[model samples]
Target chain A: MSFLAQSAAANPWFSWAYLRTNADTIRALVVEHLSFTVEAVAAAVVIGVPLAVLAYWVRPLSGPILASAGVLYTIPSLALFAFIAPFLGTGRLTVLIGLVLYALLLIIRSTLTGLSQVPPDVREAASAMGYGRLARLLRVELPLALPGLVTGVRLATVSTVALVTVGVLVGKGGLGQLIIGGFRNNFYKAEIATGAVLCVALAVLLDLLLAGFGRLVTPWRRERA
Target chain B: MNSFNQMINWLNDPLNWTNPDGIVTRLLEHLRLSFGAVLLACLVAWPIGIALGRRGRGGGLVVVLSNATQAIPVVALLTILPLTALGFGARPVIVALAVFAVPPLLATAYTGMREVDPDVRDAARGMGLSRWQLLRGVELPLAVPYLAAGLRTATVQVIATAALAALVNGGGLGMIVSAGFGIGIAAGGGQILAGGLLIAGLALLAEALLAWVQRRVTPAARQT
Candidate 1:
């Protein structure tokens, strides 16, 4: 094994040769990584937005709701996966659940913050203009809260991207599998570097995409800027 | 239920506590690595953070850079480092953990320092306090809560990520979980469950302890 590793070390760390041959594998991994991230963040938004709305409506529930989400975020990824794998099985489904759980706090907190920070006068004016409570929340509050919501989504998305690699421990690590494969294959630098680079690149790309989405949605803010 | 009972039995086992690779030894290793990483991160990040916060400039750049680092996976870093000159040992793991730890430490320290009330700072200046005196006497005290909060965040994150050390020949509770993985889950599932519980429990305990410290350090007026 040592001899093999020594020989592998002789291979260049950044090789077009490796890239060309492994292009298909890298593409598949990137797709898996992207899909997992999108699915997890989407699920988190679907679940978290309602919870945040509930917390916003019921003042007392906010504390417990956010606190519990915080607890979920605090659990180490590996431990969380291990704990859940028995019940959920070590697969994409388990990883998806874990990702969503980790993302809940960030999404909820940001959305709650965004909702709370809406100008009271704006809300009053909305009411005066015959907007009901639900209408005010849906039209006036949610739109104004777009920046904060976007920030939360960006944060959660980036974090989830990083975390998906940990899923490799359960055979669902997306790009993480390549990283581990590299390790077991005598520290194949090209494979490890590719996986790591792609992961970071994915994060940056998603963050920028979210930022663009935020700007695209908040046109009035753009004029001010 | 069976697995939970198995985990409990595993924890209760005397051999798991006293043997060479027992829980106690792994726990110590985890704590030591976590401490070293956080300390190193503090040493590297605090001075830069404090200076920037004091001057109240360059902080936006610092924040952006730190935020960028968040996207880099810890597991990837842990794996990559061992392939370098660092080789397989606690050093690479410590280095990776410290790197992961720096962003929170730096961000919080800068924010803590930057958040010092200008009025208080002006009063200190009016009293003819030197810059260093103002920082030590007024700013640092006021920033304690932020610093403590940052420390807590960094420490918890370090402790959590330190479990990845097992991937690179580093000693820690992760070794147990990975060991369980080495055998199949049917036979070694108890060890995996036990390891997860222990790791999560330790992280939560550290978080709670540090939160208490944060509360204590916060001034009465800022208690909320």
Candidate 2:
């Protein structure tokens, strides 16, 4: 029943020691946290990328589709999770679906922006080279748009990782389980801080990993810079 | 379909509005928490953003840093912060919401200010305008749309995240939501839906208001 700050106020000396004793448990929680993040981001990309392409290919559909996605994004995460529990039974499925939906608007917006902003002259040159629409999009537009796509995925990855803790409401919380445990223990500061710190670290690590991938794919951009 | 009917019944119930934990009070509380967070976020983030935008040194670092911050889940923050000296209450809720709120707002202000036409800035400088005068007469006006857009984004996000306050000791529309699920299946489902819908409605309304403000500010931002 140790509440972190309250006890920290009393005995700040042993916080690290507390974390040390729980190292193995923290490691396991981090692994679980990563898995939840990956699955959700993967699901978001599967749905979001194609939707982005569709919005690009069909100009008329873009506004409404993007608007709908924006509206969906505005729904608070806790409410959205609770909203679905009736159907999904408060498991990982409910949280995963919410994560996927939350990721879509950011992914689609980035994808559309990246794809659309490909220089018109470059597109014209592609056509002059006798490249058809699909071919031009696949080769020219897609590669040129890599920065935006990379940015989108990077943001989504971190967001998904952060949100994995929220799944505790449904008993699928990864690092969030610790936070819930902390509360149940009457504000066990060390427990909650450990979970929160790990969550932040996971987010940073995932973002850096994706940024590396972005760099690997867009090596030419570095030369330009 | 059956659940929808039940949700409607729950909405129709008089006590849902008349009780101390009624929709009206909760909505007001939600607005207050959201407003408090956004105000604090703007105060903290905007000046630093404007300063950084003037210098243009930290864009790359901030973009990466913000990505990292954005990923820290609201639930974790709510719970963990309570364990801090800030203990559970409206204060911790505002702190968490504002922390998350800062990124988008700061980014928008910085970008907006940065994107003002270089020639416009040069001309103002040529006029022997002091830095303050130039910022007021030139950059700030040109940066309106960008800053407004950022404000909108931050406000919407703060409002949305504020719903998580219910998980802590704070009260808002989330009370209905978290309480519903805690209560059970039938009654809880209906209450959750009502609460969820109300929160969603508030988000959309705030977004629309901000979007209009962004558009309204455009006269000051003459396109180069």
Candidate 3:
């Protein structure tokens, strides 16, 4: 008992000290998560936006494509990881595939809604000005749809950050490692504190960034008021 | 020829249905966990969601909390929660899954309430309904459709995430997939595939059931 008390006294704030000492790990984890999220969200936008555009143009296939993506969204993250592991191997590639698929539903739906919400009059005016389909979409439609698209991107970023934590299970790196390591070692303060800090920090940072992005993209929102 | 016939016979075997630990039993366990998590999430999030929706604008704090809680990965949340507590098992798994369900529920509820037309709210107030009465009679009914949509999303997500509970020694069909991966059985691939298929089927069933409920509960005038 004396020895235990001595040990506790010797390192009264051991967990905090340990976390501070491993600040490099925490920084690395944050960097890694942010990079992965950006990559995945970017890939999702590239693929999902085109698919959404195609679905909209094709009309008939939109329902089926959206439905399929919705169903894909229902696959548990771990299960999807497991399913993809056979083909992609259990590393960054597998994690990337899962994140991309997860983002697809949100991004695609957003793109479709954004594009469709462009006023018919705007499109007609663009056509009357002799603008082609591509020109109209680039100038008239996309700008109008920017708010909704940004909203989707913001949501997708949140999802990506959350889901990236799952990559820890397959030996990909993140703050998840700290949380998982802390748990395995039966260190309550360390585990909960680390998880709580990372979660809260990431959420606040992302929300602020997205809100700023929204404000930038939707000047009309400010002008209207 | 004999091996091929045996394989066919194995596929055709009735023993598949009557096995001591049958597929149906595993499915029931999965459903129980999924439903339990959803219920817990609804219990925790509904009041907060309703309040946030009614108040509007100031709900950013709740949204932040919900999003942060959600961003804590299921495996991490399950693993970490139990460390602070004792006897890590299904309880932690359920808590983590419930946390996962909360955000969508809250977001949906808040959006639903906020989306209630201001004109309608003004009319309700003009009719001399108290705030609570207006909420109960007008806002809630209108918000129900959106709430249902959010719940539907939550249900599907919860079911999917519940499969991960097996990682924390909370057995479900995920056990089959995990175990199959452990042994690396080419034959065990079938079990993993089967488990995946089962989850997909359950998700579809849940979606259909929720859609039906949404349609049934929503007033015909507001069907659009």
Candidate 4:
């Protein structure tokens, strides 16, 4: 008749003894983790790509933008989480801001490198065909830059997956809740191993998936240096 | 303004500084752990990197291993390592940080050596340079800048991550930060702000110092 007993009865995975405080809530936690990774990486790409292009074109702003991102990237996961928690009050927003900041430098740097790595002749030819700056950037340069862009995405996603565990400190990071739970319970193997193993497994799965996706999108990356 | 004042207030408190568990001691412990990890990582990664580069055969392996290791979140590693005989304190955290630090270091060293000019290598061989001599006289020197740069990146990363040591009795500014957060966000804001400021300042300082070292060790002639 009680809510706790009812939920425990309903869900086979739910147990009162060990993961009582939502510890073994594996399904919801995993979903939260995935969304955290996806949302953060998506935002980074959306914001970072345009900023990178603007930096490239504007020239004067490039150094500062890249430098600031680099500095932001150096802030530790937990430290950043703590700083943001007070402001955002935890949950997805804090995680999102932390991950976006972390990924920005990599995304911007790679986009710049990937665009620059394309031989000048390719651009000249595109221009000769009357491709405007915007068209050439999208059609010619962007495709060629796909390899680096994909690589950035791959790194960001994997790192973000790992970092989401830190969110446990604030009660919002996906796998982290289980991890901290285990830690507090004196390294209960089921809780600790399940959380750690699951987190590592998820990160690797995402990384491989992204790598495969990268190869599919940028076939030229494999064919060349 | 209030929070900022509180931070200064917390920081200014002499009581916060007097204990063995004070920020000063914690900072020292953090430095020791971070530097130990980076040094250990360099010892392991650079040699392996050099060997792989010499044979021109292991960049793929580095990428795979790095990605795999990177995927393991530091928090998980921090918690799990203690479950093993690694015990607690700094050993496991040091190992974990080193594992995390190895990627950039190995990747850069391998790439640096591999990217050396083919013509330069051939000329060295033609000049009858011995294998060891060629490595020392040419390849190793060429890789120094790249190695330094990699070390800088890895070191900065390691220093920042070292803060997490506080989570598991491994003392650092993280002790202050985590304690603050644990005390509840609003009430603990001062401690968190003070700790956060110190860690951020330390990270930036490490970046600048290492960048200087990277710039200096890179031979002037390698500027091109």
True contacts kept of each: 0.64, 0.70, 0.39, 0.60
For each of the candidates, give the backbone clash count.
Answer: 1, 6, 0, 0
TM-score of each: 0.95, 0.88, 0.80, 0.87
**Candidate of highest TM-score:** 1
lDDT of 3 by residue, A158-218 (tens): 7778788777546674666666566545444454467556854785688679889889878
Better of 1 and 3 by DockQ: 1
**Runs of candidate 3 exceeding 4 Å displacement:** A1-14, A20-28, A186-192, A217-225, B1-25, B47-70, B85-87, B106-147, B184-189
For each candidate, what is chain B's TM-score?
0.95, 0.93, 0.84, 0.92
* Least well predicted 10-residue stretch by lDDT in candidate 2 chain A: A5-14
DockQ of 3: 0.35
Give me the displacement of residue B120 in model 3, in angstroms: 9.2
lDDT string, candidate 4, B38-118, tens digits: 999999999899889888997789888876887888888888887678987788999988988999999998999898899
- Candidate 4 docking category? medium
Model 4 chain A, poorest ten-residue lDDT window? A7-16
lDDT tens per residue, model 1, A1-225: 775765655856787878999899999999999999999999999999999999999999999999999998888888888788766667789899989999989999999999999999999999999999899889999999888899999999999999999887778889998888888886788888999999999999999999999999999999998
CAPRI category for model 2: medium
Candidate 3 lDDT for residue A2: 75
Residue pairs clashing, model 4? none
DockQ, cand. 2:
0.62
**Least lDDT summed over 10 consecutive residues: which range in candidate 3 chain B?**
B1-10
Ranking by TM-score: 1, 2, 4, 3
Worst 10 residues of 1 chain B by lDDT: B180-189
Residue B76 lDDT in candidate 3: 67
